[model samples]
Target: MAEHAHTHTSTPSPVPDLNRNRLPTLFEVLSRRTLPPVDLFSFYIYMRDQQRSVDYLDFWLDVAQHMSLCRHYVRELRRSVLVGTPEPEKDSKRSSAILQGLGEMSHHAGPSMYATEKERDQDAQMSAFLREDRPGAHDSPQSSNGPRNRPSPGISSSRDITSDSNSPAHTVARQDIRASAEKILYTFLLPGAEREITLPGSITQDVTTAIEEFGRDDPEVFDVAKDYVFQAMERDAFPGFLRMKALGNLIPATLIMRLILGLVSMFGGFWAAFILIFLNETRQTRLWLILPFTIGVYSLASYQYSLDPILALLGFSEYTPFNFSRVREPYVRKLLAQRAIMVLAVTILIDAALCVLFILVPGKRL
Candidate 1:
């Protein structure tokens, strides 16, 4: 089952293109590669710094290493068990040697280890049992070499032999696989894990069930959980990662430009409003305040918190940041675009309302 277990997964499991000649990029990994150790580790660090979720990557890396461990244990068990069948003649000789060792320990010669009283009692019991059973069974069953027992008639041909599920080899493999499965279950899937990934109840229950069905009972243990983690990272986390990574790569010159733009928009609008209020001889102008207020609010808030939308606003996303995705993060950018349009419409309506108010009812100087 362990041998067959791998044959199923081997075909679809393409090794991620590491490209050791160049430094690994999260873009390539998130785009075309499976989660490898290095990329995942670096991503884990990035996420950790941002205080984002890293449990998924943690569990993914652990499960991959455990799968390798399962294969290793299975191979070791198979290699060790495939030596040869036991012979009755050799068994009898080994038994006789053990008996001789037990009998002669009391008075061996100059230098010898001593046996305990339990061994003496066991030796006495064995002597009595052998005297009763072998007196008439064979004239000289115990000779100088050893007591001889009849061996098997013949060895079975390779084609005639079949592997038993109850055999020692299978037993050890099951134990190894089950142990591996249990570690995964308790450490990540089960409750009270130090690094537990967020999983639905049904998925958790399925993986728990898989632990009980280790080996041939359930060859695809943790497979569903693995896919879930991978899909989530690929769909949700990677997009945000790509965006953040792009933001992280902004040039000092670009950032200085954004800073200058934000400052000019914010302060320039504020001073313009001050001058308008003064020009009106301290009569507060409502209609003229709308654009300045909008510019000031957006400039102050958008740089840090709303960076992606701001980058798209500055048109950097069309080139550097959005190079990976042909779709251009429509979900996030689209939502932000709607909000921007709404703000624009609201600003215009407010300006019109203030204009009507000023025309119909002029304000006295404050």
Candidate 2:
């Protein structure tokens, strides 16, 4: 039992929120990631739809994927190194191009290797189909039973060329690492990429220099750039993500109930204040109106007091904006929330004043 438990136990996923295993608190998302995170899809939606600055998340995930690929290649390289299997050499006489990875060994026979000029021409024609140039009507269609139709090469053979190559393990590993790093740099670090991260000039420069210097087969080539992007998202983007999830998690049944209650708490005072100030009817109505408005006032006040933290969490300053980064969607949302609460305050106060007037100096009964 102990051995089984030990063997099965693994590190917790960095993306539990994405996996839908558990939801972390706001503090965990913000504070915890600094030490490092998100529910992947939800956070992406929040950044994309609400924050309007999804490049932060996009760049982060891109680097994460690059890192994962790098690690995978590294593991495969290590295993191959341990096994010490000398890779096989290709037969030069075989056909050069392949539509798919595998077929009858005869299909691979080169046109040059055939016995006769007529057969060589035939082999060349068939080789076109094998070269994946599209398999349809041709000058020489195969005999009815012959292999005019080739089956799909299964997934496992996708890497057969690489697996059978004469190149040493290090050469393949180097190419994989170099290709991944260049792609990351092009997609994110380049000056005008479609989805660039826009790091500080120094940070981006450092990444370029590091990749140039020691990136060959180095899995951590992008670590520095990754850290900067992670910090940017952690400090600025993640809070809004947490709020989005919190609000989104409320089911329709629960949401409707909460909205009903929140609306009462939000606007009940204003509704009563309208009744008192504009449609004053009687003493009893005035007195009764006062109590609800008073409660509304309290609720709005409390919300207002707590609102600063919530706004801060929404990247209010950045969007408003602290960095003067292009102002965008979530700022509008934050502003709307603040204004709605202010309106509630105004209405509640008006009703409270009317109530005070009625109590302190009784108006004539109407």
Candidate 3:
């Protein structure tokens, strides 16, 4: 026998390069431009605050609209560094810069970081100092040193960004506002309440005022306001279940009544058997057929009554004559035998216990 020649070939597995530069491509940003400016801006701000580069912000923004449409899109974006089709490397930086500029412009109209009362007081003092120092204050539109002034469109006294408050765009913005308001209300206001207390009426008043400030473009503001009112009513109206648990006085009377009725039925079953067995021959034959019918009717009635207590109470009188008859069909006989065994077992157990107790006790009386 010729010795077999053995040959081994080892194929090299591909090693992923960890050092490769993986930045967001320009195509990702351009794709996200299909989303509404507000949603795009919001997503951009989130990415920026997280220290993600402008390229990643663009990629997330492009995928934002698709987020509502497909759940998989979010997972896919998070899994991959570059989502969507990648553009040429040269154009990526320019695309990122444009998106960043748009995001900055959209955020410009929002309240300043120093809009609080303390900040406002400091601003007032600074303005007074500037006025006194400069004597003739040249507050020019081009002056960068003066208070940062937003250009007025002169549309209305409220200085709202949009003219038509009821537009779809405005409704979307109002939703954002309502979400912010809810966060503030729940986080800051609705904590550490001991008992059911009505919400301060001023919270509702403040919400109403906030809605008005947003103007008619967003009816959702009013909807959110109404929701807060309803929530306040709910908090005030319902007592906590934990409070009622301590009382322990309110036993479900209906359940107790059902238990009594069940005990009564057990006694009735024995009486029904005795009456049917001891009756005259003609009546016995008649009752023998009627007993199964009665049992069938009572079982059905009992099943229905189990669901509703009022019906059970009203129909209790009619159920008294129901009796169990000899079931002939094999399937039915098996069911009846099972039920009879259960009843007999319970009865025997109780009787045996009583007999044992009686035997244990010293009795003089015969």
Candidate 4:
């Protein structure tokens, strides 16, 4: 029997080199573009001051760079997962390596770091100052000046880059992040201006304004609009005309129903009043007529006032018009109530005139 031989070949990974000479220059550009590190508790003024000096092109470039770093990191992770080891090594070196890679990825997306008791006082003092100053010194994933994550990963691939750049979902997300950054940047740029930005109902605009204006000359109102803006963007898609058709039908249907009820009540009230006046000698006829007319009036008034208590008490709707078909709001019912009242009033007047005419003209009831 012949001895068998096997040849094994390993392919080199395509992860970008972090130690490239240009990387330091990139960090320098990033430092110039980004707002300088300041105490989160007292960062408003400092943020405004530092951000004003940012070069627009540099700012966008830095954003692009951050996006690229995240994209490359994800690609490397995907590759590693695809090339996973089939058998576990007892020493578990590969497991440790994978964990280290994951840690590096997390660091880029981590919240702004605060000093800890374990850190040397000097290191803590120098951390913010030296972050982008030393360039390659902090370029490592484990370093203090390591790159940060953007809202999305940047990739040159038509699919990834195109989706990030142009797809509605991704585009809106990037726009939100960009808009947040811009809000802070612009606020700092024009510190003396009084600008009012609309915020969502969740955040109190007055409180936000008060906090920002505590020490500043001009009260800069920072709206917690992100929750509002993103929520508006992410809301279940508009549902279009199909969803609206039912709602649209409601207004017209409401108006029509009210008009119908009003006409019926109006004519009924007129006839009953005529009959009661014609037969005034009978007490039972007068009592029966009054009870139903009062009920009909009450029912109509209640329907109008159900949505608008103020209007109900006032006995008229300010937001709605008298014409049934012209009303666009849910206030169609209110218009109907108004119409009912007018019809009842007119019927009473007519009945009074008919009684007077019969008495004066002679033999009118015949």
Candidate 5:
């Protein structure tokens, strides 16, 4: 029994060690053609979390600048766009003119052309039926066996394709899909770019307008899209400068600094409270330490809440789980600032009340 116990104690456990799984390589991502749009969005977020997206974007930007602006390269790119010609010249006219002319004429003539053709074909069939009949046509004129007496099954009918094309439901569905795609693109590929440039709804519209103007032709689309993106970035640059100026203003800066320093005080106060309570110090001293610590924590939270609008403006909202937007109105920001002050005051009052309770009930500190 002693030997068995010693053997059991010396033996190692057979539990497996779990390692962190690696993300897919760039090559692996690029090689898979069947990946869904959500996967691309996930990959983008992963790249951002890993802090590699910034460098990747910078590299691409440098490459784009070098490839797009050089005189010879630009000319070569234009030449490439103009090279392919599956569409024959008008003089060569690969498409049949007669068929095109008939289709065009059908638009104006309506269903009457079909009616006339149908009547002529019916008349020919009637004549053929008469030729094959026995010479008793007048006798069989009212008979069910006669071709003329029979109902014509060859009557042609046409449906108006134009009506379906012009339907309100069809138009609305197309618009909805387009809007959804734009939102997805902004959320996944170009996160925060829209907020920095324009308001949430307006940025996609601006991008669509740019595409409309420049995307009509293959040659101009890339250059125009690149320019529009840069233009948006430039627009945000001025506002960021203004924000920096606002941050420098002494009154606001002082408030922000005090709130920050209060966080440190909160840390120290927590430790002091813990020591006094656990080490059997006087109840009054313990209450003093705890009250300031509680007030400090609440104030710090309120301070961060007050800066939400500013953080949203700087495009940090995309990283958050829920939606957040910048308060474009100056009045709204002022209201939030006032609310923050009120919250801090409330927190202090609550802490003071708690301290009074602790004093009144000395045995109930826990």
Candidate 6:
């Protein structure tokens, strides 16, 4: 009897049904397959891989170095404007242009130029003092012997025994300060080939005006402006690495949610189908009978979810999986492709539904 049953099973069915069903679409395949864990793994791996790249490290370092340079330049420029010896009137045209540029920069970046509110207040006070109209407010009164009553605190006093000269120590201090100031100006004003060559001429004029206006009251303001500029330049120079860093900062939260969702999605469908089959056991006989149905339902749901409008709105696509597949390593692409079929399948279904709705709705309206 067993042999007869085996022989019967071996015989082909009367109707040729082999080609009756179409292969599952991409969306269907994605939806039926496992999901949550694989999705989480992909997200984690992407972030980890980016962190390990040398470009990420170099980007931040470049920014820090540039910012330092800017701070130094601002400091020097401010000092030169304040106490450094005035350029000869013959060079006034050039000085005027430079000053104009500095002034504009300072004006535009006024808030950043001052280190603190206290510094800004001090500057305001100094400006008020300088602008006072009282005669001899800045100059010391003359004594009966035709000498100034008291040397300005800013000037040096030289007590020379051999010659009746002013204080050499004060003169030396002023000279040293002036020399340091000049070095800073040279570095800040002349960026050489590093800066964009096509900047508007107005930029120079604006920066010069800002420097003159702000530096007149407080030299530190220039330092702040210079630092801000350098930092901005550095950010522009290495955008990729900086972007990676920002992404990295969000990795923990992104990875956790992605991982949990992927895991739940991957196994949840199969379990749900099992429950349904179990509940229907009175009507159906075999324990293993529901496996195919469960798989089909899972696949269908996954495909639908992949094409969800919400995900699409967030710049994600079911066909694209994690959206990093094209940019990622080949091995990662393969892994995601293998693991993400079910999700993709669901997405495609949802998208198809939405597309149909859109078309039908528009036609109905017309």
Cα lDDT tens digits for candidate 4, 139-208: 2222222223222212211122111122121111212322333333344223342333334433543433
Q: Could you give the candidate ranking by lDDT, starting with the highest?
A: 1, 2, 5, 6, 4, 3
* Best candidate, lDDT: 1
Which candidate wins on TM-score? 2
Candidate 6 segments whose C-alpha is farther than 4 A from its true place: 1-51, 54-68, 71-75, 82-268, 278-366
Point out where model 3 deviates above 4 Å.
1-200, 213-271, 277-366
Query: Any runs in candidate 1 off by more than 4 Å, and if so which?
Result: 1-38, 77-177, 213-219, 246-366
* C-alpha lDDT of residue 256 in model 5: 73
Per-prediction TM-score, please?
0.37, 0.42, 0.19, 0.22, 0.24, 0.24
| 6-93 per-residue lDDT for model 6 (tens digits) | 1111111122122323222211111111121222122223323443332222222222222222222332333344444333431244
Candidate 1, residues 1-366, lDDT tens digits: the string is: 344332212212224553343333443343223232223333454444443666666566555444433333333323333333222332354434434343311211000112356534543443332333222322321212111111111322111111111112222333343444455677788877876778999999877754443222122456678777877776777656655433332323344555667678657655655555545543344455556555544443444433434444433332222231222232434444554455445545654554454433443434
- lDDT for 299 (candidate 2): 41
Q: What is the lDDT of residue 310 in candidate 1?
A: 42
The 10 consecutive residues of candidate 2 with the worst lDDT sum are: 144-153
Each model's lDDT: 0.42, 0.41, 0.28, 0.30, 0.32, 0.30
Candidate 1 RMSD to the real structure: 23.0
TM-score of 1: 0.37
lDDT of predicted model 1 = 0.42
Q: Write the per-residue lDDT of candidate 2 for residues 104-221, one digit (tens) a residue.
A: 2121111123345554444333323222321221222222221111112221211111111111223223244345556667777878977677789988887776555533323344
Model 2 score (lDDT): 0.41
- Per-residue lDDT tens digits for candidate 5, residues 159-247, read 11111111121112112222332332343235364323222455445444433432211112223343444444335332332232222
Model 2 residue 17 CA deviation (Å) reads: 12
By lDDT, the better pick of 1 and 2 is 1
